[model samples]
Target chain A: MSSGEAGWEERSVARIVPPIRPRKLAKVPFVELAEGRLQGVVSSGSSATRVYVSSIEAETHDFNCSTNNNRPCGGAQGSFHCKHLKALIDEAVKQYGLERVARYLKVEAAEGDDLHSLLNGKLVKAPAAVVFSRFLRHLTYLKVPAGSEPLPEMHWFPALKAVH
Target chain B: MQGVQLAELVQTPPGVDEAMEAVAGFDAALADGLSRLGPRHSEAVDALAGAVSASPLGAAAADACGELAVGSISDTELSALAGARAALLGAVHDALLARLDGALGRTRAEWEEHPADAQEPPANLLAGARSWLRELAIAGWRGVDEELVSAADQTLEALWAEPRLRRLAVLLDGLAAELRVSCPVATMERIPERRWADLWTRAVLLAHSGSWTGGAAAVSGRLLPLGVDVHEHGTAVQAQLHAVLEPRGDGPVRLVRAAVAAAKVDTIVGPEVWDLLSGHPTLLAAIAERRAVDIADMPLTADGDLLWDEERAKAGEPADPFATARVRLPDAEAPAVAPLDRHPVRIAEPVLVEGYKAKRDGTFDLGGAAIDVDADRLPPSGPLTPQLVNASTACIGLLRWDAGRWTLQPLAVRSVAKKQPVEAHNGDWALGPTDPKAAKALARSGSAVAVLTERAGKLLRK
Candidate 1:
């Protein structure tokens, strides 16, 4: 498992495409992916978001909108893509390496009429390094603010040493 | 010249000529007796009426006799005169027959010359009078012909009771209405009583035989209104009425058959037509049998509602597993309603039990019922194991009725959780651990062993 993680690091040298930043991956608190099984992105912060996936058919993507918002969705009305879906794809690339991520995203291109031709270039050019860096950043605990005061040390009593 | 010499030699009184003179004399006597009748003339008037009905030529003379009988004709002298009048009337009837024979001969001669014109359609002709000439040429007179029997019988009675020219005219009018023709009133009045009776009987029989075809039945539809006693005619007439509905026929007959099959016979009749259908029990039973067979072939549910039975769920078998027929209830002593499909309720404990069906589609069969397990309704651990061909554990779910079968909608699947048993020592003995081996070792030692429920702690001590 550790070697597989190293392999993902080795392949993540390319740059991320425009409009989607590595910082956005930090904003996504959690991601889960399984081949032909499950794909999800979850965040428990102020801006709550989730994307549950099973099949990657066009009709199945329409269901994702119904699951979250009780409406049909085809990325119409200038809503070109789902943010959570992108987050899930990026996190899968970070965890599973470029080869698995390319296969997973292959479904998106095959099912979407406009995306298939465009996604080939994006998949080949996407930087796995940026995906890993953003994923690792979220795993670290929250840091204390630099201006916070330090705690005072406690003094031990000398009489207790002999009693032991 | 030979014909003229024969005619000159025949100077003696001819029989027909003499009979005509006698008829004239009887008419004069009947008028005289009627004008001066006393109580003694009753028997003679009755005798005269009977005699007039019996003889073909005396029919006209019988008219006056009937009128005198209704009048105040009386006295022994008048009675003697009535007998004389009746004898004269009989002679007149013979003369009338001779006159009819002569007319028929003349008509045949006319037909021989212009055959088609002689037998023209009898528009506005009397039913009894239109074919008088032709009938005379063929049969001579009315009584000898088999076809004239019923007409002769009925006409004799009708003329006897009301022997007047006007009354005879009315009866001929009735016959003409049925025949749809007009006749000269004089010819109708002269028609023998037998011919009138025969016409009525023929019309009725023709109507009765029209059971198979709707055409004649439509014309015969008026029989019930005419006071015809059809039921008395036996099975032949009743069969015609009963089978008004045809089995293989089309149009009106088919429609009538469908209606009769669906309705009870008693409900189909009105009070007006009851007399025509009253005496036939066999006909009703036959109709009921036909109805049962027809209903059996219809696509119907056990409750008698028509439906298509499609076995969509049970492979090639029927979706309904229960018998759909009505069963007799022993306790109630009546027929029970059709039974519905039912299944045994599943009692699955939380513990994993074998013998339940599980599938990868997240479905199972419990107690012979198909069940769907919803992901949301399942426990957080989901299924602890992949579906086993021979399942040893089960989870209880709700039993639902759907499409004539019971289905189970699973709420949760029982999971397998391993339990760890702890062992502790009590003095020299190993105690109350669920380990069977430790307990067995102590048993083999033959030394007294104490079992502690918890870590060898002191009991009842401060």
Candidate 2:
């Protein structure tokens, strides 16, 4: 599509989901695991997607997508874009502005010992990614420890190289 | 002599003293009536009939005269005299009963020690209650006759009906149920009347204690979680605890024992309870001994210090409560503010002025610019127009540097008149200036801003 056409199309797509829809994702079950990683699940009827997001990196994530009458996507070859991933990304963008999410990704990719403090400071400005991940984690059925120190052997999201 | 006295006693006028005396004399006469009348039945009967004929209570006496006129004191005539004597005795007994009934006003302890000495059965409800309570205090629950038990049951039922007394009744009922399960009658018999009285007194005191704030006030602490069937009776449990736990002579021993019992039942009580229990030095020592036994497996010196001083070393620095107030050494100097190396300034660009402040003068600061706001650009009333206030994006403006000062001049303003950006879950954009109708459409769709934004961004790229 042409840039103007694309913009129009984008506007049309944005109109599809109400402003409240992304906010309602806050009600989703998710857990903040050890090292600040997140694990969650989202399902519609029998179709479900288990999402894992990285602790130190925002772009790095893996999802197990299963839909009716379709082969399950478990990061195998040709497993790229899925509706679940799109839903999660949409929620993150709406909850956090595009600019804020971009900044968060940049911050996460950069290496620093004071990353935790930095994340906390930046969270006030750009809370969408954290909130989105947390929402996802909340939707998950996995037992998550609360208020306790990080446990050893905590799992992290496997980096997927090919997801669009 | 008895027959003549009976004749004269029944012949007397009705006065308080005279009636009492006559009743007493009649009682003595009736006792010997049959025996005295064995040989002189007719003569005795004649004397009684003549006396009763002149008396106020003479119905029975008059009936006897008919039998005597026939030259015989028949069984029916004897029966009549017996009935008259009983009626007189009842009147006297009622007076005595009323006097005894006044004893109910005395304290329970006094009643227990000094019960009323009534010759006949109680003539009123209060009299009966006092008699029953007195007997109960001495003989325990076993001493409770059917009349007393029924009274007790009725009292419980009445209490159950009342809101205030219902709590005590419920607690008593719970205890009774528990007693039935654990020890039946055996354990209950061991509870003396004094203990029962004390329990009741304590319960009342506790119920009215008016919001006690002691350290161990977690009232249910371990009891609730362990499924320890605490009496759900309102406030009775606390009252019970106050009675049983608060006034123990050996406070610590009592507390530790309670703790031990709770521990045996797999309950971990809070520290406040221990503080109350261990308030005394002797109890503290006992607790210390028990705690020592608990931690005996750990490696420690005879003085109870850890074998390794690593924890003390790891403590790094001991914080003094009055550290700031401590005397400073002479070498210390006062703190100073650091000077900035350069003046803070930003290049000319279209920027969104998020906030503005009015200085002492009426001029406004447009994004930190110390310049006067154009009156024409200002709203008719209030500080700024709603269009400017509501705009999410920066209006096209030039940040100019003139005379070593920053000033902003607006070339054009962007108004979000048609579309208002809805805040997403993360306080981000639901709709932006790029999509004027996006917010309206998204609102119609009834989804979140974040979700719409993500999907729309993808659509734009596609």
Candidate 3:
């Protein structure tokens, strides 16, 4: 095709994509690897009032599952990675990608190991409040109405302002 | 005068520090002053005229202010006034920035802790970019109000609060200021409508620079030959070699992008990206060979992209990035603090979208987020379109907010290429090997006057 006649795929053939796609699903909407922990909010499958805040602390690998108000999860009593935390990782892989989740959690992957397999990190107790609040802050963005007018407060995040 | 000059020399020479220090207080003062104005009225117009008369502006401002005093101004005209005011401030910023730079005598202990800092592009590299227009005899905007050399104030203030963006915004302000001083007498018909759009984008890149420069680091990986993404910025064609860097060891996975920008000449720059890669044989050979290798001793910019200078690198063993099936790609993250819909930086967010289905509306939807294709920035018919056409698996690209929706300009595809499942692929097309086609496609965007390079020579000779 001629210049402007380029098809969509052929057109997008060159865009400065970020290193990779974010690896999280909508089920566990807000996940971030931050402050020595892999933490985020996993939406409640049954009750919206009791969304779970799950976290896995780096180095210690200490994991926690609780409500937004710090109530403990019955499924996460022991040192095992619970379903909520697993879901968080699953989405984290979608949002952040699997490799970054392993690196931040410092997982030494053997050949053909799922994120859970071949990992030697312990689970310990930590607060769920901060991660929950962070998720709440993240939710605020979805409320912003789309418009052509630019927001004065809206600029590229300094953190992502790579040379690219 | 000599005696006065000799007395107690205060080292106040507008250096980088002074320019940076001045930035902290201007926004608050601007906000305060704006608050005092309350609302725009007939009186407000007269007061603005008075302010323009009192300010150190040229004759054009007086003429525009006089016109505003006679009749009610429209919204665009009002914005023009604000833009010109902002531009005047930017001119001041430019003056201070230029004065402060290059005068520090190149010796500072607090900064430049690294010896490689010398290679850092001088802070004032493009600070005075507006000067180019005057030298080249190019026309610049003078605002709808006929206010001298204006940029949209709302657009400028949106970025003015950010120190990094502030540095750039101030320089842009100066750019408008420079234009005003250089050619202040443009007629009302000569002022283009929405002139600031091009200025906003051009000045953003020209004035601001990355924090990290002049440091070499080695990273080895299987360079997934994703694709070459290109953008036509003014007279320049910016092409990026987008790839996935699967580590030689257990290092974190990185999305590597090596950029090659060139001028768009009179002729077409062939259809393929392969011709662009021929300049750097190391990267081209590795991509063409399609093997795992050690890419060593490359300059790392602050934003984490390794500059591909066709120098110092080695080779390594093969490794698969998809062994784990899922990738938690490192850094350049989506704004965690805001929802994707409301995230301010969504305008510049880098996205890797997967599991997205093509909609009948000619858009792609991942879960619920809609992505339209930006048709302007695409390569000419030759390369790969990514996961859309084939197996429609996944793709790497940038996401930009345009019109009213998010537009996707994909760079690479991990789908079925040539009837085989390939992880990362650009396309089947490559430009000529440094021949006429290759030279046509690639011209350095960093070096200004992409279109005028040839035309300018003839203009100057006259």
Which digits, one per residue and each the tens of the lDDT, describe model 2 over residues B383-426?
A: 12333523423322223221122333332233345676321110
Greater-TM-score candidate between 2 and 3: 3
Order by lDDT, highest first: 3, 2, 1
- Which residue runs does candidate 1 get wrong by more than 4 Å? A1-108, A111-164, B1-381, B384-390, B402-404, B410-462
- The TM-scores, one per candidate, come to 0.15, 0.18, 0.39
Off by over 4 Å in 3: A1-164, B1-128, B132-195, B198-227, B233-235, B243-256, B272-277, B287-293, B314-350, B385-391, B414-424, B431-462
Deviation (Å) of A6 in candidate 1: 49
DockQ of each: 0.00, 0.01, 0.01
Residue-pair clash count for candidate 3: 36
Please give the range of 10 consecutive residues that has the lowest summed lDDT in model 3 chain B: B332-341
| Residue-level lDDT tens digits of model 1 in B92-144 | 33333233223222111110111111222222222333233123222322222
Tens digits of per-residue lDDT for model 3 on B203-234? 43333342222333566555554454544321
Among incorrect, acceptable, medium and high, the docking class of model 1 is: incorrect
Local distance difference test, each candidate: 0.25, 0.26, 0.41
Off by over 4 Å in 2: A1-41, A45-79, A106-164, B1-442, B445-462
Q: What is the interface RMSD of candidate 3, in Å?
A: 21.1
